[model samples]
Target: MAVNQTQSSLVIPDNNASVSGNPGPWTEPTFTLAAKVRVGVTCCFFLIASCSNVAVLCSISGKRCKSHLRVLILSLSVADLLVTFLVMPLDSLWNVMVQWYAGELSCKVLNFGKLFAMYSAALVLVVISLDRHWAILYPLSFTSAGQRNRIMLWTAWITSLLLASPQLFLFRLRTAPGVNFTQCATHGSFTQHWQETAYNMFTFCTLFVTPLVVMIVCYTRILWEIGKQMKHKNELARSKNDLISKARLKTLKMTLVIVASFMVCWTPYYLLGLWYWFQPEMINQTPEYLNHSLFLFGLLHTCTDPLVYGLYTPSFKEDLRSWIRRISSILSRRAKNSKQLAISELNIKDLTSMEGPTSTAVTMQSVF
Candidate 1:
């Protein structure tokens, strides 16, 4: 029998290209160009907004502002910033330009970073929603702080790392058959097909669907509590305006914004992915439109995270204002001090002149 080189386990064919030994079906170039432009712009927006949020959060000091929620917000902001700065930009560049300029190592790093940030963000949002729900529903029972919250945060980090590990193994950069450019994708082989399927299912369910359900339930209960509180006609204005009640209202509003932003940012991507999962044939038939649409939807998450930060975090705004005010005060004080020194020097010179010959001779001798 002839040597069966094609049947070897070490060799794998790129399924992304056409069967005629060509690179691709070569869909409309316009779609790819538009998708690239959109992703690039969105990534830039994400980077700017997330970096601003991180700066704002870092400026906050003192004890009153350092709650569990604040800490969680900071973590989320860091995660968002990482995704914006590290993952989305690279991914956008690759997809939009239709080339992976980065090497294999970068592809792996991007895959890991993207999955890590995404899962961490999703988990934190769920935790925030639950924290708000508990604070609203059972205020006395959920007094976690300091060590407890730290422990929980550590746990979240570990969980996120574990959840995102699979992506590192599953994704790789590979040259498409007969093509010069490499693309990032799951390793497609007979042995890895089932693994990819399982990975996709797990990622979709845990990172998107499950947390989304939990958020919906938690927010619904929170809204119900707020409505109940609002309807109490006999409730004293003093109690309504109490610090705890006001804080609760603020928490509710923040939670609403978080959930809304999460849904708005991720829903399109989830829907697009679901369509692809259920109908893989669409990839070959309408690769340009479907892929571009999916890419655009995915970019939305990176862009909307900063909006969530701005809407939800009052302390972020306060800290920004405080920094501006502090700088202004410092500048003002320095200017005043300089003016006072100038006035004092002028007065001293006038006094020296008034003291006549003795002081004038002494001043002239010191100057010489």
Candidate 2:
């Protein structure tokens, strides 16, 4: 979901220069600064970790790496990275130091990036859940990996572009009356309202609610499948242990991890949005403290994405281990070389002592 910076009920004045209409108080600068700093640091950490994992996963070139789910995971990483690198940094800066100081171009770019990333990520998650559900419930009838991957890729691109169209078309920079800086927001008009409503409904339904329902249902069915497998194993006396069974177990674990993380990360943001939707006037009447609190909670999703990848991807852990080993090896070699050089100097001093005619002679030779 796109983050809304303005209070819901606060209306902008019609005249650019007049401050006649009293719309509620603006958010406090200090509180906003703290919120931005906290969010920025969190997003930076997630971005670094997630991008590192993505690089590692993409570098793998074997049969195990060529799964449909892995492709979806990569797509998710890219989408989250885009949000972290392209959108959140500028958003934090705008929130803390310069409320929309970067100008019209920045405003447009940030808006588009935020909405596009969010929509794409949501779409990928939904696709992943559906794929898992089909594979587990109807193994024989499941779609080919190539077909699913192609369709999801197309959907991600098209949905993101479509979702972001509103920002590109409706967003503009307008001077807030009596305020020195310009604000980037939806233009206030009937057309803008209908357009934003349509965008919100699309996002709320397709991106948030639909995916959430699908994940819950899919995971529930998966649990049922696992139960059936376990029961069959218990009852059968001559069942063969098979490679397929092992692979299925591994896939189930990974799916559980992904679904759990996605739900935990995204639930707060969607709940907050729903809350705001139900109580439109709360934004205007609520104190800055409450609004800022909601904003921070909403941003937690961006901060938790990398942790999700690390929890699910075995390749990510292996790559991290390899990185640590390389660093350790480098340090060990440097230390060994330093020790060898120190021993060589000592040996040279010992030889000079043995060849000296007197102690003073030996000390002088060593000094030279």
Candidate 3:
């Protein structure tokens, strides 16, 4: 029940950098008045996001469930974790420095990884939504572990990579006339205008719009099925079937919340990106601060997913708490040992000082 999927549309292609082909003497207002503070805040959120998602992965690893839902949950957690590790730090650095210091290949790889993570997260959630739809509607015919389900998971990754492949080719280092430093930009040509537009449209539809529609439809069907099942609930006693019904309802609600969170977090960024796609001049008119704000909002989804997991999944909470306690215990023991070591050394020094030159034998056991 460790359901998690947070896809950010902010890391799409960074067209803002690309759009500035011919530079002028323009002042880019750093998003927040205190740019350092904003950078610190973003970095803190990314760190929290990284830690929480890694904890989710640890929790998942501690369990052994062969259910297809479990597999999907693992996939989603891994995708989100990758976003935290691979994308968030670079995002923070870019926000603060406002330049691509890591060079061309890194820029391409960074963009590719970000897009890959976003697409994979979206695809996994869509598949999970569909899986739940089938499970609820065709209970008798449904099984979590199937060869088809494995194929579907594989296809999801393959398709995400294919969709994200453009990032690897399109993004590279570029320089504007006035800028001294290079920036990571998607190179756009006059002939590739339609191609760029088409690709952006495809990414938006496939990663955000289509997934939202599918999840909404699937959850709608799931709700209808749950309502129908409830009508027959009185005929059966409080048994396994009843428990399953309750569990299904709980899961449906959890998934709805997760989906809602994803929508709220990414919609602004994606919508703004789409607007930028068609009306490139609008970018020049838009406040520099607003773009960063939208990107930060979308970035928040990475941290929010782990919180959603803790709220919805009791088992995940327990496992995560257990892992935290284990880490705390290890730290505690190390601290204690260090303390004892210091005390023992001090006692030995005290004994040597007290008992004069030949006092090598000290009661270290007593000190301990």
Task: Identify the runs in model 3 with alpha carbons over 4 angstroms from their true place.
Answer: 1-38, 64-66, 144-146, 189-192, 231-238, 361-368
lDDT of 3 at 40: 74
Which is better, 1 or 2, measured by TM-score? 2
Candidate 3, residues 1-368, lDDT tens digits: the string is 00010111122233434444533344432434544555676788877988888877777675554466667777878878777777677666665666567878887887888888888888887877877777678777555445556777899999989988878787777664554655676644324566767777877888899999999899888888777767987776888987886777677677677777888988887888788777655665866566667767777887887788778888887887787799999999999999998887887888878887655543545554
Q: Which candidate leads the pack in lDDT?
A: 3
- Pairs with backbone N, CA or C atoms under 3 Å apart (clashes), candidate 1: none
Candidate 2 accuracy as lDDT: 0.62
Rank the models by lDDT, top first. 3, 1, 2
After superposition on all C-alphas, the RMSD of every candidate to the true structure, in Å, is: 9.1, 5.9, 5.1
Q: TM-scores, in order shown? A: 0.73, 0.75, 0.84
* lDDT of candidate 2 over 1-368, digit per residue (tens): 32544322122322111222335545423434546555566566556655664654554433455467667666666766666665556555555554456778877777777777767777776777777777777766544865877697788779778867667765678665565646676645234434445666666787678878887888898889878878888653544435655665576676567667667766765676655554444444555455545554544555555565566667767767887898999999999999998887787678677776566566657656
- The clash count of every prediction, one per candidate, is 0, 0, 0
Q: Highest TM-score: which candidate?
A: 3
Candidate order by decreasing TM-score? 3, 2, 1
Model 2 scores a TM of 0.75
Question: Per-model C-alpha lDDT, please?
Answer: 0.62, 0.62, 0.70
